[model samples]
Target: MSKKRKRVSRRRLAGQRVLAHVGVHNIETGEYKPVTAARRYIAESGIVPPALVNVRRNEHTTDRFFWGEKGLFSAQYAEENHFLFPSLREIVDRIGEENLFAGLEALASDDWEEMEEYEYAFV
Candidate 1:
């Protein structure tokens, strides 16, 4: 008997408009810096295990990049490797593992008007 291959659905974000450049936030100091400045600071200070927060936006929605130990990851990646990320672990603890994906989907489908409340700085 032949094994059937599972089909994977790919979501596209090609039409999204970039609202801002990549920004780095220091988890300990709560400081936000542009990518270039963050790189310099990380190099000079030798910040242990530097991670980057990348944002992708469009006229309608936004997507955030989660920086893992291995590399940049999406929400799905964080779901799969929740153990590797502190934030995701905390979320799982609060919301339960099963509901994590549903919550993320809801957040992603939320109205764009709510996103306008905060000003996004273009680095």
Candidate 2:
């Protein structure tokens, strides 16, 4: 008799690393393929991608998102691009506990003045 195996769903597994590799033998030949790799990680421990709880400008990228005043849960590009657990503990492990908390606080205040002060120096 054949044995029956249990089946699993994609939701039960974490998102696979979205990666790609490309190379060209010669640029003159018009082969300009570009290589790519998972620039960030993903987490699908839930039935759906984590809801976007907050958003803020990267200071570097200037990407706009829901600010402190606009309290609403929406999927921001950044969150979607770097999806992770919907809990603080999980997020802290990736971004570091200190930075994670600071980010939350900063977004809560909708104040980027402090971030802006250092922006010029980075340039």
Candidate 3:
């Protein structure tokens, strides 16, 4: 018999801000694509894990991706679920995506190191 998984409620902590949006991007063409396109690209390209591309959402938002054995996932999501995959945990520990991408605007911007540091600090 198969074990049923419990459905967990998605809740936000106080002061938490919702992301404006999430989507994929084509680096060469500089076009933003839907999430569905990301999945399709991963399947067709057969890219290796840990390979990723970045996309700029706006002046304040930049999205980062990590290619996994299963497919592409946001760095934040990969960190949150790293416990489920050993490879992911190693990548998160080594790359520190939160620190790496924070305040780093996309497209030739290298000011990430100048930004003020902040912690996740979930309650």
Candidate 4:
């Protein structure tokens, strides 16, 4: 079962400049590789990870219960679409809030088993 995200009264991360590395997650393997190197891997392999949300600063956000990073899911958008999400909240809009978080949490932790749990899981 997936954990429920908390409804915080206010987003504590507002206006905070956090140190973060850009990276991509293999939706199939739940593996995370930092960018440039990750870009090369994707190009040479011709495989696109379902999501690219691998930022280290937001690792703190994941510390709450699961590896939950609100703004991080955009890494995938950046990789696939060649641009970062203008609004991270849109991740919720596109993938659905629960799915964006849960899907990403699975990727962030390198949980290949959890990733493969899906019926359409990639080989």
Q: Is candidate 2 or candidate 3 better by TM-score?
A: 3
Tens digit of per-residue lDDT, candidate 2, span 43-109: 2122122222211223332222211112222223223222222332244355553543343432233
Candidate 2 Cα errors over 4 Å, as ranges: 1-47, 53-86, 103-123
The C-alpha lDDT values of all candidates are 0.37, 0.24, 0.43, 0.31
Candidate achieving higher lDDT, 1 or 2: 1
- Model 1 over residues 1-123: C-alpha lDDT tens digits? 999975322111100111111235442222433334434555575544324443323344434444544545554444333445454344445665344333333323332333323222121
Q: Evaluate residue 84 in candidate 4 and report its C-alpha lDDT on the 0 to 100 scale.
A: 25
Q: Which stretches of candidate 1 lie over 4 Å from their true place?
A: 1-54, 85-123
> Per-residue error at 25 for model 2, in Å?
41
- Better lDDT candidate (2, 4): 4
- 2 or 4, which is superior by TM-score? 4
Q: Ranking under lDDT, best-scoring first? A: 3, 1, 4, 2
RMSD of each: 15.1, 20.1, 15.2, 15.8
Residue 102 displacement in candidate 2 (angstroms): 3.6
Prediction 3 TM-score vs. true? 0.37
- The number of clashing residue pairs in each candidate reads 0, 0, 0, 2
Per TM-score, what order, best first? 3, 1, 4, 2
Write candidate 3's Cα lDDT for 45-95 as tens digits.
765564554555556656666565566667566444433434544543565
